[model samples]
Target: MSTQTSRLSPEKVWLGITPTLWWNDDFINIDIGIPFEQCISEMALAGYVGCSVGHKYPTDRKTLKAALDLRGLRVSEPWVSTYFTIAAMRKQTIQKVRQQLAFLQEMEGGSEDPRKADLVVAEFGHAVNPLPVALFPNCPNLTDGQWDQLLDGLHDIGRIAKEEGRRLCYHPHLGTGVMAAEAIDRLMENTETSLVHLLLDTGHLAAAGVDPLAVTKRYASRIKHIHLKDIRADVVARIHADGLSFESAIEAGIFTVPGDGSITTFPQILTELAEVGFAGWLVIEAEQAPAKANPLQYAKMARAYLRETLGW
Candidate 1:
């Protein structure tokens, strides 16, 4: 990782990590699943104050909150897949957004100093990440008409989030329609900044051959949330050379905690965010095989790196 230090204050952002490291949500069959108690406990033990909800998280609000509170952890955000390109899925997608927002509201500490968890949305329609095809070749190219539907659908979704006291953070992901730098730029240029904010994922951008630092500098004003991780350049090269699927690349150990891999642009990216006075959740969200990557050990590695470099 780059050795550059950030000017961003530790208090400016809520540092969190996702439980996806402990339990693979996309490929549930890749089972190295640990108990829920151990997951959150290990996160807090590793010094994260918050986390995004995972598949293993309890459905009951009170139950989930209590478990997290015991370990000084809280929900940072939850991933909500949106099928905006497909007209039939639009209504249900909005409904799902409403339900997620309600869950976040219920998870809030109290009204005294209320901090609402933002919503993470991604275009999942025609997504190929979960399939068995090569991610690079299989990622769908959006038609002009599909683009219209997606942008319009996102506007409606963003409005609802704004009404509910939450910011909508759009996640540009691998094997999805909006995974590349150009797609991300188009989304940012067209969306209502107040309603739809960006959720910059360093690992995804780096793997897609885009510089994370450039994206951060370009969209810093609209970024409301972040997913921090590093990808092994060698692994990424192999994925492309071998025509690997997203799942296959992950299984091949393409992603890892920030400082544990070859992506050395994090410090520069974080510095850019700090310079822009960005304030929100910086989540450590790298999904890897638990058996191969050791979740707790990697979490600690990430925590130590953040402390050493960013003073988090």
Candidate 2:
């Protein structure tokens, strides 16, 4: 038996890949034509057993499950945006979160498989995608009051998700206000450990010039979900130099599958995860132009690397 299939006791881990590498969910114009079946089929072909929700995915529970069932895949997590800073957005945020939880809780691949966690990134709103990176000069920072609201809102949502038997994990993104090491430290400091958990994405952490290994060591216990996208330092430098838009950075190949990027700390990060008995999906979530980086090829590369490094 392989560690990827069966690991040490008490930790239930699975490998998954997001569909963004095949089709751009945020920027529809990039890979508008990739079929959902082709993307997921390739994922299973690459030896992945789980997948995160993508824009092109079917929403009907039975339909999606039947499709994934045919390919032996299950949903790991789906991206949800919670705009907690704006007071006026509270009602809307809760309503949106409820809808997400309602649907995700019903999502099941097989009767034998365990339930996966729900993921949310504390972001402003949908209309803010492809944000102009140069405007912030660094990155957006939440006001003190907004920080309070954000933490409280996460608790509220976390309570709701718990009631529904799902765990909520927060993702710190590159274009969001929570883009720095200090910012993440502040979030971990202020937010309740149980109510609000972290969804650490190594690509985003490295892109923000923060060491993923250090962050992993600091918050290993709080993490319930993981994203293993690799990033290139030279491309990150170019983004800062050109003040490029978030969309441009992705299209310019700032992110890639693990073992193909400049970041070389995954072995330590995985060790830390194991040390803490971290359990859940370790998803590959690199957003690259499909024309340049074939998603299937990169998927194979990612799986091969993990297999070699983790002996899975």
Candidate 3:
């Protein structure tokens, strides 16, 4: 994952970490029994000053702020899953989004703050990521009708989020209906730019067999958030050939922190960001088992790599 690139200023490219490294919510057995305090403290010690909300964190503003502020960390974003393939889930999704937006807005404590976090969402429509291997190859692709439903719902939700003084960044995650490059193209082509934005994740893009920097160039204007991750490309290939579930692939160590993986395009991605004057959270999100890779050590390694490469 080594790359040689020019650096962006510290203020322009804020570094953050996702708590998935410390305590994975999807597969509890892999969490290594790390407490919330320990996780945040370790992140601070590892040189990260911001993070996205995870399952272990408090949802309430005051309690959450107190814990994070104590550790010199601020919230960057939060993931929200939306099942937009059906009509019934649409109302529930919006209601939930409104609640989330309200919480983030309240945290900002003003009409609009540049530091306010965007709401990151992934379409959880018939996602077969954690299911058995049989379901992985058979993962549902969005039908024309479903695409209509999704794009309309996204436009509505994204517009409303904007009206509420927040941004909505769509995350095209693996095992979802919109993981492929063609699907992402359709999404960007259909969705309103003023509302829906992109959350470009490096590892997910590579795992999906898509070139991450190409996506960055194609959708530079719409990218509102970034998730800098790395992939063991060989492991990813084997997972696809063997028909492994996302969970199984993760457990097999298919992902890792940047500078510890095979992603050589990392520097090019950073150069693209620098060229665009992009200024947002560069979240280090490597969803790997903590039992094998100590979260604190991995976090420190990533921090040191970024500092050396970006000269922050």
Candidate 4:
């Protein structure tokens, strides 16, 4: 196993900002209104060392490299935010995973920009309500067959990533079937670490009622990337009371920037990452009400908080 260097210096933990922060229109959010090159330049101007390329953004190597070169920014990770039905065991779902792996492989090999050659992130385990009956009456959960399929699929993708000199980071998102701490443990245990890794999102962990800091300490060896977000517990309560869907709750402003919400344990989490020698990009990802706060301004504040409280 390749080990991360000991003690990531302050400079090593690159503070990155996703472009979605500034763009409000979901349709054009990933495709910034400005030219791709100009959009990247703006990100760099905002003091972000890197920008995560979402699947919605340009995935073509030529275009991606041009933008990175113009902005002097690195592609921290390719955020493949697709919903993979780990438990459905559907042929189409399995095919989508294959397609994603192929895309990642192409990006890894085609990009002349070395920074763009990092791992492709894949998320698993979301159980949206109005659930399918395969696992639940209205939600989707992994059946035994689906579980085996998911494991086999991940092993194949992991091997592909390793061959291409890339990595695959499995993201455990809240609202996903694998949201709980135990679920996360099971997912990790079932997969080969050499084939896939973890992308720990602190906000999701906390919102799911797990101690994010504890998970970080326990799985420090597997975490390759981190998404820094915070949530409001009151909002969470309201969502539960109203039986609001995750999408509806987000529309109602349940989530917020890392420091603007009730995630008081973040500083300790950051300290833990430091102790574990985790030197990677810390991306600020807020998918809340964009109109409530200016994204750029929010990012500025988030960066300031990270530096002040987290000693980043």
* lDDT tens per residue, model 1, 234-261: 9999988999998899999989999988
Deviation in Å, model 4, residue 271 alpha carbon: 2.0
lDDT of 1 at 215: 92
Instruction: Please provide the root mean square deviation of candidate 1 (C-alpha atoms, Å).
Output: 1.8
Pairs that collide, model 4: 87-142, 125-176, 125-177, 126-176, 126-177, 131-138, 131-139, 132-138
Model 3 vs. true fold: TM: 0.94
Misplaced by over 4 Å in model 2 are 1-11, 109-112, 125-129, 133-138
Residue 63 miss distance in model 3 (angstroms): 1.5
Model 4 CA lDDT for position 28: 40
User: Per-residue alpha-carbon lDDT of model 3 for 85-172, expressed as tens digits?
Assistant: 9658988998889888877766666734356688899889788885765434867798999999999989999988899767899998
Report clashes for each candidate as comma-separated counts: 0, 0, 0, 8
Largest lDDT belongs to which candidate?
A: 1
* Alpha-carbon lDDT of model 2: 0.81
Better of 3 and 4 by TM-score: 3
Give lDDT per model, in order. 0.87, 0.81, 0.84, 0.65
Q: How do all models score by TM-score? A: 0.96, 0.93, 0.94, 0.79
Superior candidate under lDDT, 2 versus 3: 3
Rank all candidate structures by their TM-score, best first, as comma-separated numbers.
1, 3, 2, 4
| Number of the top-ranking candidate, with TM-score as the measure | 1
